[model samples]
Target: MQEIFDENVFKKGIGRQINLPFLKAVSTAFKNIRVRFGRSFITIGGIFFSLTFLMSTFTNNVIAQSLLASGTDEVKFLLQPMAQEVQARQVWLISLSLLVCIIGIMNAMLTSVTERYREIGTWKCLGALDRFIVELFLLESTFQGLIGSIGGAILGFLFPLFVNIGKYGTQVIEVLPWLEILKYGAITIVIGLVLSIAGAIYPAYRATQMVPADAMRQEM
Candidate 1:
């Protein structure tokens, strides 16, 4: 019975040890985010605006559809020019905006790695693995993306309502399909998360390649 109890204790210890690296990396990432709140906020803001812009295109398309379905000649005529412009340029605009977002995220993460050179060196010297460093940065960006995406989606959904209300009052707002708007919001969130991860890949890889000695020599 004593031997069995010892084995169980050992297994539990092993399980905790196995989870220690992930927990440490996550904790360190959160600590760094708190310490570098300004940079993180900038990154999140960029993501929020980019996603909001992208989702605005989707919102515009939906609004155009609603206008077309209204069966009012005056409404159709009023929206026709705008609808054509959106159809012609929406894809290009979304693509350009998404590209900008990715670039912004990558730049932010790279700057973060550069600014934290000394801390990273310390972690390396303290026996942190390369993958742990990568994981830490990725996790931080993922959290930022999540917050930014939700904020952007909310703003995007409201944008059309405001515009329509301003143009034709609240009665025009009823034409919108709430369910479709929700679906577009969900897509935007997924896109934001994916962009965050994709943007971090190069910076994370570059960070892993840094020599601890060289990083430590740099001024913070």
Candidate 2:
């Protein structure tokens, strides 16, 4: 029993040691996000809108499927007339929105890097490595993406729910597929995370490439 207890303690110690640096980086990223709340909100807003559009499209498709499965010819007639056109357009619109959001995230991250030149230099001067800097920015963006995606998914789900409620009253809830919502919400979260990470890559790399001395010399 004593030996087992000692082994457990040793494992716990190792786990804490492994997680310490990651915790520090995450905390530092949170501090930077709080400091730049306005810019962070803008980045999140872009993600929110993009994911909202994508999820709303998915919701529409699911609703159409539900309507068809119910064997409601009238409802199907009303929906089917423009379903193909709307489906085609949804692809284009989602792509465009994602492109715009990606650009917004990239711009926001680059601006952050530019504004934090002295801070980055100071961190490097204090033994912070290039990977640490990259991790910091990535963590910050990932947090933003998580928040924005969650908000977008809720908004997207509500949009369709409200519309269907108005049309079908409480009957709408019966046909709505909860599983599909969960699936799409998960996908949206992933997309948000990927877009944020992709957007941060170039800026993080550029920030690391700058000489600490040169970065510190810049006047904001």
Q: Kindly report which residue pairs in candidate 1 clash with one another.
A: none
lDDT of 2 by residue, 143-194 (tens): 9998999899889889987887687566567777889889998998899899
TM-scores for every predicted model = 0.85, 0.88
Query: How far off is residue 167 in model 2, in Å?
Result: 2.7
lDDT of 2: 0.86
Clash pairs, model 2 backbone: none
Residue runs of model 2 more than 4 Å from their true location after superposition: 1-20
lDDT of 1 by residue, 1-220 (tens): 9999999999875555323378787888888889999999999998999899877778878877887787367778887777777687878888888999999999999998888888888777666777888899999999899999999998987886688778766656778787898899999999999999999999999888889898889987
- Residue-level lDDT for 194 in candidate 2: 95
Worst 10 residues of 2 by lDDT: 12-21
